[model samples]
Structures are given as C-alpha cells and as structure tokens.
Target: MRFGYFLSCEEYSPAELIEQAVAAEKAGFDGIWISDHFHPWNDEQGESPFVWGMIGALSQACSLPVTTAVTCPTTRVHPAIVAQAAATAAVQLQGKFVLGVGTGEALNEHVLGDAWPSEDIRLEMLEEAVELMRRLWSGEVVTVRGEHYDLDTARIYTLPDEPVPVYVSAFGPKALEVAARIGDGFINTSDDADTVREFKEKSGGKPCQGGVKVAWADSKDEGIDHAHRLWANSGLPGELSQVLPSPKHFEQAAQLVTRESTAESIVAGNDLDAHVEQMRSYVDAGYDEVYVANMGPHYLAMIEAYGRDVLPQLRG
Candidate 1:
C-alpha cells in the first residue's frame, strides 16, 4: 500500500510545515494530509494558517500529493469559493492535489455565529455543496439556488488543466453512504478493519486512504506523554470540534485524556508491532493507501523510523 503522512493543526510554523513535507517526501512518503482549521484545537496546540495557502507552498517545496483532511464547504466557506481554491491548488501542484472535504466542525464553521445544524441537515448541505462544486468545475457559468446556497452567474476563469479528485472524510454510516455516492475517494483516520470495509463497500470501489497518528520517541513512555499533551483532544470523536467554542474548552477536555489512553490508541515504544497492527486494518480492508500522521514534536525522527525500521518489515 502507498504510505502517506498527515500534517495536523499542531505547533507547526509555515516554514516547518513545508520543511516537514519535504522531509516526509524525501523519506519516502507517498502523500501528505493537511488539516484545514481556523484555530488549533487549543491554545496549547497553537498555529493554524489558511490551509489553501500552505498547500500552495507545499506544492512549491514537495512533489507529494496533498489533501486537506479536510475542508468543510458547507457554511464557513461557500462551495463555489472552495471550488475555485481547489482548482487553483491543482494547477499549482500540477494535478497532485485532492480536494478532501466534509461537513466541517463547529470550531471553524461557528465563526460566523451561524447555528450549527444536526447531522441530517449537515449531510443535506454537504450534498448540495458537492453538487455545486461539480457544476462549477465544468468551467461554465453556474447560476443556481439551493436550500443552503445561492449563486449568481459565477464562473471560474483560472480552472486547472487537470481535474482535482474530491475525497470525502467520513465517520458514520450515513456519512459513509454520502461519501460513497459522491466522492472520488474516501479518507479516514481510524485503522478499524470493519469500519474501513463498511466504508469501502459503500464507496463503490473508489480509492480509500487511512491515516493514524503516533508520537514517536526512544521511550514509549515519552511518546505517550507527548501524545497525551498534544493530541488527546482527538479522543472525543464525532466533531466534538463543533461544540468547543474556544481553545479553553479543548484545554479542559484535553486534561481528561491520559498517557495510557494515547498508548492504547497508537503504536509506541519503538515497537514495529504497533505500527504493523495499525497498518493491518487498512491493508486488510483493501485501502489504496495508509498514512501515518505523526502527532508529537519528533516528526523528523518518526519519518526516519518509518523509512528504516518500519517500511522494511511491512514490505517483507
């Protein structure tokens, strides 16, 4: 399976993000997944730049394909605008960018003070958003009115020479069905075989990608501690990202997670066993690729370990 890396919304400067993308590609990663966030989960996490801008920068620095895992086009940004951005990015990356999208989390969507809708409503919006984007990409004037969005005679002049495949990020059954129906590809962070299988079945044989986070270090304990301090917020699944109004909420929930939880969730302690186990689910589920999202400070070393200590065992 192709191996990739996730660029999360942690403490990464723009230069560092580009530097890490280059490092990941040089170390043999196939692609990179970047988080699209207006704010990091917490102040403790800090530093989120406009993801489209950074994708452009990565295009200049790294040859690997990029996916924003993911950008929600429903409320925060109009679907037409996202269409333009994705097309432009595809041009810059020479057709190596996937427009990964979802219904979005509240932290980013709530910025306009728009009331967050329920799952069903969000799915409805997502369907319209996808439809809108597809129409816009045909390089014709799009004038339409939908339940959630209305566009006048709008057109995108700077269309990409190549089409940007749209990848959908999904977690639930209904959402998975939507991804299957509309997405060119599917992306997920979990390594559960059954879950991936369920999604793939619904996806109608579309390409799939799985990504998991790990904190790497010489000591397993050190790695778990780092994971707890930095990524514990992820434990609260189902867009807990929507309810959290500010960084302080993340800070508070982050405290609820312990080092043990992280250890249980990820491979650690320089043991190839854990990483191997992590890859098994996606591999067994027939994913086209599996990505390792390094969750701690020592990303450089983690990529090195994957290239040296990890990949060989998987290939063998």
Candidate 2:
C-alpha cells in the first residue's frame, strides 16, 4: 500500500500546509490528501483555508499527486463550480488530481443558510451532483434539469486531458451503494476491513483509500493532550459529526469526549512501533493507499520521523 500525507485544512494555516506538503514530498510520502472545510471542527483547531486555492498552490509547490480527502460539491459549492475548479487543478497538477467527494456535513454546508437535508436526500443530491460534474468535465456544452440541480449551456473551458477521477467517501451501506455506482474509487477515514472489502467487491476492484490521524509530541501524555484538546470530536458517536451545525456545537459535544478516550483512539507520541502498527492496520485492511495526518504542533518532526523510521519499516 502507498502512504501519503493528509493536510488538514481545518487545523493549519495555508503557509503551514504548503510547507508541510513540501516537507511530505521530501520525506518520501507518495501523494497528498487535503481536507475541504469551511470551518474548523472547533475553535481550537483554528483554521480553514479555501481548499481550491491551496490545491493550486500545491500544484506549483510540489510534484506530489493530491486528492481532496473529501469535498462536498452538492451544497455550499455547486457541482458545476467544483467541476471547473477541479479541471483547472488537474491541469495545473498535470492530471495528477483526484476529486474525492461526499454528501457533506451540516458543519460546513449549513453556512449558506440552506436547510440541512436528510441523509437519503443528501445522497440523491450527491448522485445528481456527481453526474452533472462528470458531464461538465467532458468539455462539451451541457444542459440538465435534474431533481437536485440544473445546468444550462454550461461547458468547462479549462479541461484536463482525462476526466478527473471522482472518489466517493462513504461510511454506511446506502452510501456504499452510491459509491460503487458512481465513484471511480472509494474513500473512508477508518481502517475498516469489512467496508474496504465490500466497496472493492461491489465496485469491481476500484482503488480504496483510507486516512488516519495521529499526534506526535515529546511524550505520550503531551500527544494525548493535543489530540484531546483539538480533535476530541473525532470520538463522538453516531451521526453527531454530520449533524452538528457549527464549530461551537462541535465544541459543546466534544466536551463529552474525555482525554482517556482520546488516548485510546488516537496513536500518539514518538513510539515508532505504535505509529507503524496503526498505519499497517489500513494496509492489512486492503487499502490501496492510506494518508496520515498529525494532530499537534510537532508536525515537522512527525513527517521527518515517518520518512526516517516509519516509512522504511512499512516498505520493508
């Protein structure tokens, strides 16, 4: 399995993100995955730069292939606009871009003041959006009058030689079905063997990508502290993440997430063995590629250490 770095737009400034990308390339990461968010998960995480602009900057900064770990093109942004932006990014990256999309969460999408739809409705919108974006990428003028969206005489002028691959992010059966039908690939955040196997089986062997978050600091305690403070929401149960409407709501819910839970859930500190084990779970689970994100201030050290110790062992 290939290993890549995940740049968290929700956590880092644009300059820090670009620096990390460059460092990741130097550290021998295979590619890059970037989060697309309008708001940080909570105020503590502290930044959310426009992902499209960052993609453009990354294209100019490094040769690493980049995938938006997931973007929601169905709501805050129109699929037509996503199509144009993705096409331009692919061209800038010389066709090394993958548009990873999803049904989206209220945290980011509700900003436009639109009512958050149910999961089924959101899935339908995603299906329609994906279809419309694909049509737009063909470089032909297109018109559509669909249930969720409409297009009139719209055509993408700046196109990549090949259509941008749309990887669908799914966490459940219904979403998986839509992913198999529409996605060029599959994306998920956990090291879930059953889900990965099911997606591949249903999709006829398309690539499956997964992502994990870790905190690296001087000691396990320090790492746990960072993870708890910044990403405790990651431990929330059910659809709470999908339904929480703002950073404040997320913060309110995350208060229920204790440091012990964060410690148990997140790989922490400079224990190379622990880090390797977490990543290997994704590999063993049948992911084609896995992206890793650092959750604290020691990101530079984390990347360098991965290059020096963790990556070599994994490759071996």
Candidate 3:
C-alpha cells in the first residue's frame, strides 16, 4: 500500500505546509493529501490558505503526487472553475495530481451565502458536476444547462497529456453509490473495513484511499491533549460537520468533546508498535493508499520518526 502525509491546511501556515511537503517526500512518503478548506474547522486551528496557490509551490518543491483530500466542486466553486484549476494543477504537477471531489460541508460552501442543499440535492449536484468537469477536461467546449449548474462554451486549454483522475469521497451508502458511478477512485477518512469493502463492491474494485489523524509526542497524554485541543472537531457526530455553517459553530459543538474521545479517535504517542498497528488497520481494509496527518506541533519529528521506524516496518 502507498503511504502519504496529510497536510492539514487548517493547522499550518502556507510556508510551513510547503516545507512539510518537501520534508514528507524526503522522509519516504509516497504522496501528499492536502485539505482544501476556506475556513478551519475551528478558530484555534487558524489557517486556511488558498490551496491552489500552495499546490503550485508543492510542484516546485517536491516530486510526490498530490491530491486534495476532497474538494467540493458543487457549491463554493463552480464545477467549470474547478475543472480549469484541476487541469492546470495536473499540468503543473506533471500529471501527478488527483482531483478528489465530494458533496461538501456547509462550513466552506455556506460562506458564499448560498443555501446549503440537502444530501439528496448535494448528491445530484455532485453527479452533474463530475460529469461536467470530465467533459471540460476532455478539451470539449461544454455547454450545459443542468439542474444544479449551467455552463456556456467552457473549455480548458492548460491540461495535462491525460485528464486528471478524480477520486470521490464517501462515508455512507448513498454517497458510495455516487462515487461508484462517477469516480476513478474512492476516498474516506474512516478505517472501517466493512465500509471499505462495501465501497469496493459498489465501485467495481476501483482504488480506495484512507486518511487518519495521529498525534505523536513524548508521551501519550501530551498527544491526547494536543489532539483534543486542535482536532476535537473531528470527533463531532455525523451530519453536524456537514451542516455546521461556521468555524465558531464547530468550536461550540466541540466544547463537549473530551480528551479521551480524541484518544479513541486518533492514534497517539511515539510507540512505533502502536503507530504501525494504526496504519495496518487501513492496509488490512484493502486501502490502496493510507495518509496520516500529524495532529500536533512537532510535525518534523513525526516525519522523521515515520521515516526511521514506522515506514520501514510497514515495508517488511
């Protein structure tokens, strides 16, 4: 299985993220997954730079393939614009980029003052968006009058030799069906084996990607504190994350999230055995790639540790 580092745009400065991308490549990571967000999940995480600009920096700094963990082409950005941006990124990355698309969360899309559509409507929009983007990527002059989007003679000139692969993100059965119908690959954050299997079954055995967040520190307790402080929003119940309108709302919901909840959700501490075991869960689940995000301040150390210890054992 391929191993990647998840660059949390919400947690790091643009320069720091770029540096980490370079470091991650040197430290034996196979690829990079960067979060595409307009706002951080919580105010404390505090940084969300334009992901496209950073992707350009990454292209210059490292050779590792990059993917937006998931971008919502249906809402905040029009599918036509996303097609253009993705086509440019693929060319810049020398065809080493994947456009990971999803139905999207309100936290980012709601900022445009558009009403948050229901799941059914979002799914419909996502299907149409993917279809439209693919058409544009093919160097076709797309003129569409769809239910959710409208386009007029859109064309992408700066495209790679081949169209960029699009991986759709899904957590539920309905979403998985959408991914199966349109995606070149499938992506999810959970390590649930059954869910992965279900996705594979639906997608006709397309490539599957998984992402996990971990906190590595001198002690497990320290890691737990860090995870709780910076990533508590991750543990919030389902649907809440998708519907929450603002980072402030996310922070409010996160108030009830405890340190123990973080410990359960996130792998923590410097124990090589534990970290390896956490990653093994994804590998055993038939994930083609598993991306790990270091949830604390000391990402450099985490990169070195994974390079020195975790990655080597995983190879064996």
Candidate 4:
C-alpha cells in the first residue's frame, strides 16, 4: 500500500508544513494530505493556515502530490470557487494536486450562520456542489440553476493538462454512496475495516486512501500523552462531527477527551503487532492505499523508526 503524511495545518507554520512535506517526500512517502479548517478543531491546537495558499507553496517545494484532507464546497465556500482554485493549483503543481472534499464540518461551515443542514441535506448539497464544479471545469459557459446553486456564464479556461481528480472524504453509508457515485476516489481515516468495506462497495471501483496517526516515542506513555494532548477528541466517536456549530463548539467537545480517553482511542505502544494489526484492519477492509500520520513532537524519530524498524518487518 502507498503511504503518506496527514498534516493538520495547525500547530505548525506554513514554513514548518512545507518543511514537513519535504521531509515526508524524502522519507519516501507517496502523497501528502493537508487539513482544511478555518480554525483548529480546538483552541489548544492553534493555527489554521489558508489551505489553498499552503498547498500552492507546498507544490513548488515538494515532489509528492498533495490533497486537501477534505474541503467542502457546498456551504462555506462556493463549489465554483473551489474548482477555480483547484484548477490553478493543478497547473501550478504540473498535475500533482487532487481536490479532496467532503460535505463539511460546522467548525468551518458555521461561519455563514446558516443553519447546519441535516445529513440528507448535506448529501444532497454535495451532489449539487460537485456537479457544479465538474461543469465549471469544462471551460464552457455553464448556466446552471440547481436547488442549491445557480451559475451563469461560468467557465474555467486555465485548467492544466487534465481535470483535477476529486476524492470524496466520507464517514457513513449515504455519504459513502455519494463518494462512490461521483468522486474519482475515496479518502477516509476510520481505522475500521468495516467502514472501508462499506465505502468501497459503493465507491465504483475508485481508489481509496486512509490516514492513520501513530505517536512514536522511546516510551509508550510519552507517545500516549502526546496523542492525548493533540488528538484526543478524535476518540469521541463522532464528536462535533454533526453537533458542533463551529470550532468553538468543537473546542468544547474536545475538552472531554482526556489522556485516559486517548489511551482508549489510539493504538498505543511500539508493539509491532499492534501497528501491524491496525494497518491490517485498513488493508483487509479494501483500502487501496494507507497514509500514516506520526503524531508527536518526535515526528522525525517516528519516521526513522517506521523506515528502519517497522517497514522491513512489515514487508518481510
């Protein structure tokens, strides 16, 4: 399976992220996935760099392809804008960029103060949004009036050698179906084989990528503490995924996930078997590729260990 790094675009400056991208490429990572958030999921995690600008800069500095962990075109930003931005990035990258998108998070979408739509509405909006983007990319005068959007004399003429691939980031059945039917590929991070299986069955034979975060340290306790401090909320079983109105709301929900919770959420320790088991779950579930995120201050060590200590054994 292919491996890549997942960057939060928080807790790191643009220069730092670009450096990380370079490091990841040097480490033989296949791709890079960057998060798109107006704010960190929580205040504890400060900094959310402008997503497009960062991607553009990284494209110039890194050899590996980059994808937005997930951008939503339906509400927070118009799909047409996303298409145009992606088109520009595609040309700049010489075709090393793919637009990874999702229905969206309240953390980002609530900025407009529009009532958060239900899952069905969000899915419906996604369909219309992607359709709009695809239409706009043709460089044709697309005068489309849909339930969610209306475009007139819309066209994108500066497309690169080809259309940028669109990958859907999905979490459930209905969203999974949408990803399968429309997306060029699928992106997820459930670490649950069953979730991937359900997604693939609907994803129309599209390629799939999953991101798994691992904290590597000389001691397991240190690793666990690091994971807890940074990503404990990921353990909330869909915390703020639907309920939070904004990053502020997410911050509130995340406060519940303490170090004890982190121990439960993540696969702790340097146990080769545990890591392998985590990786196996994704592979067995039909993920075409897996991106592993090394979460900790000692990211360099994590990468070294993966290469020098973990890879040979996994391959063997």
Candidate 5:
C-alpha cells in the first residue's frame, strides 16, 4: 500500500503545515492528505487555515499529490465554488490533486447559520453536488437547476488536462452506497475490512484510502497526554461528532473521553513496531493507500522517524 502523510489543519499553523508537507516528501511519503475545517475540534488544537489557500501554497512547496481528506461542497461553500477552487488546485498541482468530499458535519457546515440536514438529506445533497462538480470540470458551459444547487451559465476557464478525481468519504452504509455510485475512489478513517471490501465490490474495484492518527513523543505517556489533550473528541461515541455544532460543544463532550481511551484508540510514542502494525491494518483491510497524522508538537520528529525506520519496514 502507498503511504502518505496527513496534514492536520486543526492543530498546526499554515507555515507549520507547509513545513510538514516538505518534511513528509523528504521523509519518503508518497502523498499528502490535508483536512479542511472551519474550526479546531476544540480550542486546544488551536488552528484552522483556509484549506484552498494551503493547497495553493502546497503546490508550490512540494511535488507530492494532495487530497483534501474531505471537503463539504453542499454547505459553507457552494459546489460550483468548490469545483472552481478544485480545478484551480488541480492545474496548480499539474493534475496531481484529488478532491475528497463528504456530506460534512455541523461543526464546519453550520457556521453559515444553515441548519444541518439529516443524513438522508445530506447524502442527497452530496450526490447532487458531485454531479454539479463533474459537469463543471468538463470545461463546458453548464447550467443546472438541481435539488440542492443551482448553477447559471458557468464554465471553468482554467482546467487541468485530466479531470480531477473525486474521492468520496463514507462511514456508513447509505453514504457508502452514494460514494460507490459517484466517487472515482473511496476514503475512510478506519481500517474496516468489511467496509472496504463492500465498496470495492460495488465500485468495480475502485481504490480505497484510509487515514489514522498517531501521537509521537519521546515516551508513551507523553504521547497519550498530548492525544488526550488535543483529540479526546475522537473517542466520543456515535453521531456526536456529526451533530455537535461548535468547538465548545465538542470540548464539553470530549470531557467524558479519558486519556486511557485516547491511548487505546491512537497509536502513541516511538514504537515503530506499533506504527507499522497500525498502517498494515489498513493494507490488510484492502486499502490502496494509508495516510498517517501526528498529534501534538513532535510532528517533525515523527516524520523523520517514519522515513528512517517505519516506512522502510512497511515497504519490506
């Protein structure tokens, strides 16, 4: 499986993200996955830069292929706007960009005062958005009056030689079905073999990608501490992540998440064996690519370690 580095916009500044992307390339990572968020999951994570701008800067900084871990085109931003931005990014990256999209969460999508839609409605919106984007990417004047969006006589002037690939993110059956129907590829955050197999079967063997977070520090305890402090929300159960409307609510909910749970859920510290095993899980589950994100302040160290020790082991 191909290995990539995940750039967390929630935790690092734009400059730090650029530095990490450069480090990741030098570290022998194959590509990059950048999160698109309007706010940090909580205040402790601290930063969220405009993802499009970061993609622009990234194109100049590194030759690595880049994918937005997922962007929501149905809300906060219109599909037309997302398509234009993505096309521009594709051109900037010389067609090495993939637009990974999802129905999105209330945390980022509701900031425009738009009421968050239910799962079914959100899925419907995503389908329509994908259709709109693909049409726009055709480099032809497109006019559409659709269920979730309306487009006037619009055309993307700046275009890549090939259309940007759209990878759909899904964590449930309904979303998975939608993804299989519309996406060029599939994306998930977990290494669930059944889900990956199901998508591949339905999508005629489309590529699947997975992402995992690890906290790399000098010791296991330090890593756990950092993971708990910054990403405890990751442990919250069920639909809490999708429904919670703000960082404050996430912080309130994350209060119930324990450091032990964070340690259990996230691979922590300098255990190269554990890191390799975690990544291998995705491969074993049938993922074509896996991206790893480092939590806390020691990301540079983590990147270097992965290059020198972990990645070589995974390859072997």
Candidate 6:
C-alpha cells in the first residue's frame, strides 16, 4: 500500500503547508493529500488557505503527487469552475494530480446563503457535478441543464493529455454506491475493515483511499493536549460534521466532546508501536492508500519519525 501525508489546509498557513510538502517528499512519502475548505472547522484550527493556490505552489516546490483529500464541487463553487481548476492543477503537476471531491459540508457551503440540501439531494448534485466536470475535461464544449447545475457551452482550454482522475469521497452506503457508479476511485476517512471491504466490493476494485488524524509529540500528554485543543470537533458524532453550519457552531458542539474523546479519535503520542498500530489498521483494512495528518506542532519530527520508524515497517 502507498502512504501519503495529509496536509490540513485548515490548520496551517500557505507557507507552512508548502514546507510540509517538501519535508514529506524528502521523508519518503509517496504523495500528499490536501484538505480543501474555505473555512477552518473551528477557530482553534486557525487557517484555511485557498487550496488551488497552495496546490500550484506545491507543483513547483515538490515532486510528490497531490490529491485534494476531498473538495466540494457541488456547492461552494460551480462544477464548471472546479473543472477548470482541476484541469489546470493536473497540467501543472504533469498529470500527477487527482481531483478528490465530495457532496460538501454545511460549514463551507452554507456561507453562500444557499440552504443546505438533504443528503439525498446533495448526492444527486454531486453526481451531476462529476458528469459536468468529466464532459468539460474531455475538451468538449459542454452544455447541460441538470437538476442541480447548468453548463453553457463550457470548454476547458487547458487540460492534461490524460483526464485528471476523479476520486469521490463517501461516508455512507448511498454515497459509496454513487462513487462506485461514477468515480475513477474512492476516498473515505474510516479505517474500519468492513467499511473498506464494502467500498472495494461496491466499487469493483477501484483504488480506495483513507485519511486519519494524529497528534505526534514528544509525550503522550502533550499530544493529547494538542488534539483536545485543536481537533475536539472531530469527535462530534456522524452527520454533525457535515451539517454543522459554521466554526462557531462547531466549537459549541465540540464542547460536548471530552478530552478523553479527543484522545480516542486522534491517536496521540511518541510510542512507535502505537503509531504503527494506528496506520496498520488502515493497511489491514484494505486501503490502497492511507494519508496521515499530524495534528500538533511537531510535524517535521512526525515526518522524520515516520520515515525512520514507521514507513519502512509499513513498506516491509
């Protein structure tokens, strides 16, 4: 299985993100996965750089393949615009970019004042958005009047010779089925073997990608504190993440998530065995690729530790 670093655009500045990319490649990561969001999930997380701009920088600064851990093309931006952006990124990366997309979260999409649609409607919109993007990527002028989006003779002027592969992110059975039917690959956050098995079964064996969050620090307590302070929102159950409307609301909801909960959700510590076990769960789950986002300040150290003590074991 291939391994990658998950660049949390919500948590780091643009320059810091670039530095991490360079460090990740040097540390033997196979690629990088970047989260694309207009706003951080909680104010404590502190930043959300425009992913396209950061991606352009990464293209020049590093040689690793890049994928949006998942971008929402269904709402915050028009699929046509996302098509153009993905096309440019693919060319910029010399065909090494994957456009990972999802139906979207209310935190990002609700800012435009568009009422967040139910999950069913969001899935429908996502399907149509992917179709429109594929059509545009084919270098054909596309005009569509679909239920959720419309295109008016839109043609992408610049594209890689091979179309950028679209990886659809799913957390539910319905969305997983949709991903299977329409996507070039699949992306999910769960490391559960059942979940990964189900995705592969439904997707007819397309590449399955998983992402996890950890807090790597000199001590377990320090790691726990970092995770509790920054990622407590992650412990909110199920659909809460998708439906929470803003960072403030998320922070409010996260108040219910205890420090212990944060530690449970985020594997935090310096124990090499603990770190390896967290990743091994994904590898054992049948994920073709697993990307990790180190949640604390010791990012470079985490990368070094992974390179020296983690990835070699994984590869072996």
Q: What digit string (tens of lDDT, one per residue) describes model 1 on residues 50-93? A: 99889889988988988888899998899999999999998898
Instruction: Assess candidate 6 and give its TM-score to the true structure.
Output: 0.98
Worst 10 residues of 2 by lDDT: 255-264
- Winner by lDDT between candidate 6 and candidate 2: 2
Model 2's alpha-carbon lDDT is 0.96
Model 2 misplaced stretches (Cα beyond 4 Å): none
For 38-81, candidate 4 gives per-residue lDDT tens digits of 77766666778999999889878987888888898988888999
User: Lowest summed lDDT over 10 consecutive residues: which window, candidate 4?
Assistant: 307-316
Clashes of each: 1, 0, 0, 1, 0, 0
Report, for every candidate in turn, its global Cα lDDT versus the true structure.
0.82, 0.96, 0.92, 0.79, 0.95, 0.92
Residue by residue across 168-273, what tens digits does model 2's lDDT show?
A: 9997999999999999999999998999999999999999999999999999999999999999999999999999999999999998988998898989999999
Model 2 quality (TM-score):
0.99
Q: Residue 192 error for model 5, in Å? A: 0.6
Q: Worst lDDT window (10 residues) for model 1? A: 234-243
**Over the full model, what C-alpha lDDT does candidate 3 score relative to the true structure?**
0.92
Clash list (residue pairs), candidate 4: 180-203
The candidates, ranked best first by lDDT, are: 2, 5, 3, 6, 1, 4
Q: How well does candidate 1 score on lDDT at residue 48?
A: 89
Candidate 6 clash total?
Answer: 0
